[model samples]
Target: MKVGLFIPCFVNELYPHVAMATLELLEGYGVDVAYPMEQSCCGQPLANNGDSSGACDAALRFTGVFKDFDYVVAPSGSCVSHVTHHYPWYIADNADFQRLQPRVFEIVEFLQDVLKVDKLPKPVHFPHKVSIHQSCHGLRELHHASPSELMIPYQSRLERILQLVDGIEIGQPERRDECCGFGGTFSVDEADVSVAMGRDRVAQHEATGAEYIVGADPSCLMHMGGIIRHNGRAIRPLHVVEILTGRGGAA
Candidate 1:
């Protein structure tokens, strides 16, 4: 299928490898993925900051870039959630664009739901216990948890994908669904609360004695990661897509 690859601004800049892995994973699954170099922000930052007008320009740019594709997929659930969930609210007056929002899908959701990729990348050995921090957007907004509730007693596509990686023990965190306090602009505006929440999240992960905390959202990971690093902690945060794509470590 022809797919438009939407790389969020931070993913393009700081986590380029995650985007790279996304491409590789899609291509490996026989998807005809194309990147529109002209694609820019999904305007989530501006929208979250209560500036819908600023978001409109970016949304228009985004819609123009990926409108032709059958599906728009991104590695970020938060970004996809913004476009699919929030963009409609921003452009409620524009009936044309509101209908287009449903075409967007977060990468894992696309792979699991649409493509139904049962076989994944060859398992890589990490040999360490790791905890998972489910990003709020991915879990709650995107309904990643819904499938688990329906299909089985307990199941996470993220955890199941991680299990494909050899020697990686998935540890359960104290409050698995709690936010890491990195609500994009929330981190900068409420520095103390942000750090405190991150510290608490890290402490819970550390309590599990896991070497790494893994999740799909990089923004949350980066926030908690900074706290983990600042306090001289050994725990590290990793993106679930990175781990699934077998690009988890420094190369």
Candidate 2:
């Protein structure tokens, strides 16, 4: 399948190698992947911050850059969730974007739903106990797994894929679907609460004896990573794709 990759702002600027692992994994699958430099933010930050006008502009630009691809995929669940759920709010009745919306996917869902991938890379091996931190957007918005509020049963697409990785043992914290408190603008606007939430979430994961914490979206991991660093903890944070590529958290 032809793919257009959308790198979230933070991943593009700060965690570039993590971004490369994501791109490389898709390419490794023999899928034709394109990274459009013309791409910008998914308008999530703008929209989340109550700037619908700016978000609309970003939305249009995103559409202009990715509309032609068979699938528009992003390493970020939060960003893709915004596009899938909120983009139409600004561009009311825009047929072009509406048609493209369903084709867009967050990377994990794209892998589970599109590629039907049944295993990790042939040579991938991550021999460590890691806990999964579910990104709120990916979990609640995209339905990545069964939310704690639901009585329904479900499976995590990301975890299922990770289960196929050799020598990789994936675990979960006490609260499976709790947010990492990095709700985009929510972190900045509610600093104390965000950190408290992060601390609590990290503590739960740490209790699992996990040497590393991994998740489909790095934004959530990034928040918890900060808490880990500040507290001088040894737990490492990583994108699932990084482990899937056998790259680990290497520089």
Q: Whose lDDT is greatest here?
A: 2
Q: What are the per-residue Cα lDDT tens digits for candidate 2 across 96-215?
A: 798899999988888889998887655776778988888888888899888888888877877887887878788889988788888877888998999999999999999889888888
lDDT of each: 0.83, 0.86
Residue range 29-142, candidate 1, lDDT tens digits: 889999999988899999988897899878887877888888989988899998888877767566556556777999988988898777775556777788988888888788
Note the residue pairs that clash in candidate 1. Answer: none
Clashes of each: 0, 0
After superposition, candidate 2 runs with Cα above 4 Å error: 249-251
TM-score of each: 0.91, 0.96
Per-residue lDDT, model 1, residue 47, is 90
- The TM-score of candidate 1 is 0.91
The C-alpha local distance difference test score for the whole of candidate 1 amounts to 0.83
